[model samples]
Target: MDWRLKRNCSMAPRQLLAFYLSLCILSLGIATMFWFQGARMIMTFAWIELFAVGLALWVVARHATDSESIVLRNDRLTVEVANGQQVERVEFQPAWVRVEPAHGDQSLIELSGQGRRIAVGRFVRPELRSQLAQELRHALRRWQQGAARPSPV
Candidate 1:
């Protein structure tokens, strides 16, 4: 497969941060108005709400960088998976790798070879996982055939 498959989250990190900041500011602004009106209980509620929002944003931020990048180039297949703070990278010869589903036919695609196993197609919908596997198989087959051809003397 002469292709690069990148599956990143739909929301960017900056966008998520900006949304969290803007919403917090807006909510706090309304709370400040209520606080000045002598409704002191509203202030406590507002603080609680702020804390809740912050927690939610923290969770979202953790997974904001989740992505999978699979690149096939120059007789090498590179698979990169990023989840939160951990990242995994593995390389395999296109001709030696095998592609299949990790579980059922609808499950995630697994590419294994040379003592390494990598699962891809998380960003793809579950229904399309089989399709993705088929495509990967076709690409690998083509790559193997091309690599096996003899060069002209």
Candidate 2:
């Protein structure tokens, strides 16, 4: 069976804040070094840091509010939106699996079928984890039973 879905990614407010703060600290650190070194070298470093931060910010903002959570297909289980990268080609083979919402304050969906465990949505909100887990469980069952729809991909 082959399935393809587009997943969206969103980060928690605290996480976003932390990331921004980290970036700011990094920028400041570079600026401080420039200050001690005088004008020329520091100015160049500042521009580079600004460019890096701009790219990072753009990527984060663009994918942060995507509505799709996870895309599960025949040969791929892509988790979209972590640093704008996709985790794909996850095996959907059913092998004694348990699907559950992870314990803790985070909104995370964890899949443990056999000895393997993977965290699907560490960045998603807690309220959405159940639905995602249900979808995964259904998909896995279909795949395990050899009932999945055939895919060209």
User: In model 1, which regions exceed 4 Å deviation?
Assistant: 1-10, 147-153
Worst 10 residues of 2 by lDDT: 1-10
Largest lDDT belongs to which candidate? 1
Give the clash count for model 2: 4
- Scored by CA lDDT, what does every candidate get? 0.80, 0.59
Best candidate, TM-score: 1
